[model samples]
Target chain A: MTISRVAIIGLGLIGGSIGLAVREMLPGVATTGWDADAAVRRRAAERGLAGTICETAGDAVREAELVILCVPVGAMNAAAEAIAADLVPGTIVSDVGSSKRRVGEALAKTLPGAVVIPAHPVAGTENSGPDAGFPELFRHRWCIVTPDHTAPPAAVEALTQFWEGLGATVEIMDPAHHDLVLAVTSHIPHLIAYTIVGTASDLEDVTRGEVIKYSAGGFRDFTRIAASNPTMWRDVFLSNRDAVLEVLGRFTEDLSLLQRAIRDGDGETLFDLFERTRAIRRSIIEEGQDDARPDFGRTDH
Target chain B: MTISRVAIIGLGLIGGSIGLAVREMLPGVATTGWDADAAVRRRAAERGLAGTICETAGDAVREAELVILCVPVGAMNAAAEAIAADLVPGTIVSDVGSSKRRVGEALAKTLPGAVVIPAHPVAGTENSGPDAGFPELFRHRWCIVTPDHTAPPAAVEALTQFWEGLGATVEIMDPAHHDLVLAVTSHIPHLIAYTIVGTASDLEDVTRGEVIKYSAGGFRDFTRIAASNPTMWRDVFLSNRDAVLEVLGRFTEDLSLLQRAIRDGDGETLFDLFERTRAIRRSIIEEGQDDARPDFGRTDH
Candidate 1:
């Protein structure tokens, strides 16, 4: 089925980029965008990200067949409520939300009339805003979808193909599994990045500047993660609070042990830890997740 | 005086890179290098990195007017002592060691007849060994010189000019100051990376693979640093114990505060810290340390 009319509820990086990708990859997709920031919506429309900018979520979802909700996790319910009444009976509501379960919970409660699917395209840069969005953001990345057990099979299949067409390898999994995997992989890492960058910011100016300059040694990557959309991460922590806290606890305990070993000058423990992690990096390289080059995905090639 | 004969003692990343850079950038500078691994020395000469492969540090330094010690911190003294008697009188000796005070102290005792200058060029990739060396490693980076007040002025000036000629902006500082600053900037950050990567590696297999796959989220940065020359970093932590421990203390306490804030669900505290860090990243960009593009140095212009 050709998708002509599409609604993007948040005109930020993910939403704007999805719209841009759809426009570029699928020629006739008519994107109608809505944003809390009116200026963002206007700019998105002006930049040809959307065919039209809608005045409200209600207006945005009205008559739209494919509605993409890209707002923060905390705002998903209200956004859902605002659009649910206006969503056409046959509309398929999808989200680019980080937390699938939370979005699924909101949609299950608020949008029973619509075919709701929770999606997370594991692709993005630290940049946010309509201008930062580009059509190629999703190319050569993974897009995971979590469909409710009771949802229509046709809707699930259509959404998978839609993402694949946008240059993503679609993986369907249970919402809980997605959360757990992401908690280890994406969520906990971002939380730690936020924490470390936060810790460094409290230091003296000269030290902090040195941290950034010599960041190539390791700290700069955390800075980039810490620079991510703050509001989005806060909600991620709050919504996925349990899993995040558990992982953070493990990380802290491990760090404490390493700190103690360093203080005691235990070369054995240090070397052991260093040696094992080489395997993890090796595994990533073998699995083709990481490029063999020094930089990740940042192809100097 | 023209640097007609240059001897590089140690054929690791820093030493080999220096040999390669000097060969390409300064065609007139004749170079000979030595490493414990004879095969590595042969490869260096084959790659045009050195004019000749010396059998020993003594052989390398034998009539060279400029002898550079490029061994690890712990090995600096022994390497210096081994070549001390073979050094030509009035020869200018310098080093590419990371810690200044320690290297300076060792060099002062080991090479009493030479004009010894301690220098550190802040350049590298995570990869090490002879093959890991690149000619452009020091280009456009900072190379610091820490000279004793009693040292010959001409020797210090010549060493500074050599680094400058290699495209490194030379900064002269006290040995103690260099140690303190680098501890905050480089050592502490590297220690933290090793700690975190160690944390991730200890996880169960299911979670471990996912960690690598989604490492682009942030953890990959730590992996690179964690993958750095272990023996070199082990020496750094052990040799610079006081500074590393002091910085680690501050970092740990700050990390505890973040842990508390997260447990307390203190959004404001988290927000304040996260926001403050963004400014440091901005400053790093302004300071010409980081690329200011939307996605950091990652986005290709």
Candidate 2:
């Protein structure tokens, strides 16, 4: 069952990018899209994000062999329910949510007997909305597809091929494990970034102007991450609450240890941890997961 | 006094960059540099990090009008002491340490009565050592100069002018205040990054390969920062203990609030803070402290 017709439920960064990518990479595949926001729908249409920009979610999914919900994780249930009545039987229902377990459960609950195969494309920028996407956004990125025992083997294969057509390498994993991995890699990092940026801005001793001036000193990197879509992140934390809180607990514990080391002037302990962390960085670069260029090659220097 | 003969002690990233910048920006000024590490001195000579790569610190500063120490903050005392006997009276001594207050005090104590001015160029990449130096590192970056009351006005002005000549905008700040500001800007950020990366790497449920494979999901940004020179960061935390601990306390408090919000599913609180941080990011871009492009424009996407 090759996916020939696809419907995207939200025309934000992820949905819009999928629409553009499907058109570019799989020319034979037809695409339709809809957005909750009228302005975004108009912009996605103007940008030619899909072959057809449907006015309603139900209309969008009526002929789709695969329907992908790209809304915030918290809105997955509503998005799934909107298209449930129109989705053809055996259509592989999936999503591009950050948290898999919650989204998978939501979709299943909302659309019983649907072939719900939740997936997460671990690719994005600090930008959102229809204007923030491009066809190449998923190129060379990873898209993890999580399928439960209920999903047919053919539908799972079709969803994997569909993501591959959009220029992403696909990995199969359990929904529970996906949630935990993403919590460490995405959710907790975003939470920490948001916290630090807020902390920097509210410091009484350091004015916001001063923080802005010296931000190149490392704070700016966190600011970029913190600038991510607030609605999306708020929903991510809420939906992936258990995993995020678990990893966050470990992070806080580790932080306290480092703080104690600093207080005691324990240079050896600090140096050991700092040095050890560098090996992980090298592994990340070697794996092509990050830019190896100094300062991520952000500036000319 | 115009700095005609400048000496840079400790030929690492900051020192080598200073030498190369001075040679390129102020051709009339001569640069002599010495590093405690023999291999580094050899590398510095091959790269022409300075006009003259001296065999000893005494020789490096003997004929110099301005001396800049670029060693780890913990080594500032020894680096300063190494050149004390050879320094010509009234030579303005400065350093490029991240922590200013301790460095200022260390320089003043080791080279009594000599003009000591401490400055920190808030510029660098994760790479360190002589080979990592680039002439353009300081271009468009801020260099904060902190001179005590004992520093002569003329010497402070000359030091400020020297930094300006290297394509840096110089801001005069109190050493204590500079410590406080940098704690928020650099030290705490590094500490948090190191802690988070360590936490990710040590997770039992998540394989190390899994962490690296999905790092682009925001964990990679922190890894880049955590990969910075470990010795330098260790010294920075130790030297700026008071300020680092104080600001860290504030950050922990902020994290706790956000953690509670996540636990309570308080999306409104998370959304508010996330939205507020975007303004800071915009200001950093507008002020030219960071690249406005998303993800620091690190990847093609």
User: What tens digits encode model 2's per-residue C-alpha lDDT throughout A242-272?
Assistant: 9999999999999999999999988999999
Q: TM-score for all predictions? A: 0.93, 0.99
TM-scores computed on chain B for all candidates: 0.94, 0.98
Task: Report the C-alpha lDDT of model 1 over B1-301, residue by residue, as the tens digit.
Answer: 5667889998888998898888888888888898877788888777766788888888888878899888888788788878877887779888887788877887888778888888989877677788888787787677888999877887787788788777787888888877877777678777777777776766663367667766655566567667778778877776777777777777778767766776778877767766666776666666665546555444311
Q: Fnat of each prediction?
A: 0.38, 0.85
- What is candidate 1's CA lDDT for residue A80? 86
Supply candidate 2's per-residue lDDT for B30: 96
| Candidate 2 lDDT tens digits, B1-301 | 7889999999888999999998899999999999999999999999999999999999999998999999999998889888988888888888899999878877788898578989999999999999999999999999999998888888888888888999999999999999999999999999999999999999999999999889889999999889999999999999999999999999999999998998898889999999999999888888888887777877734
TM-score of 1: 0.93
The iRMS of the candidates, in order, is 3.2, 1.1
Clashes of each: 0, 0
Q: How does candidate 2 fare on TM-score? A: 0.99
lDDT of 1 by residue, A101-190 (tens): 877988877988888889999877777787888887787677889998877888888888888878887889888777767777778777
- Model 1, position B126: C-alpha lDDT score: 72
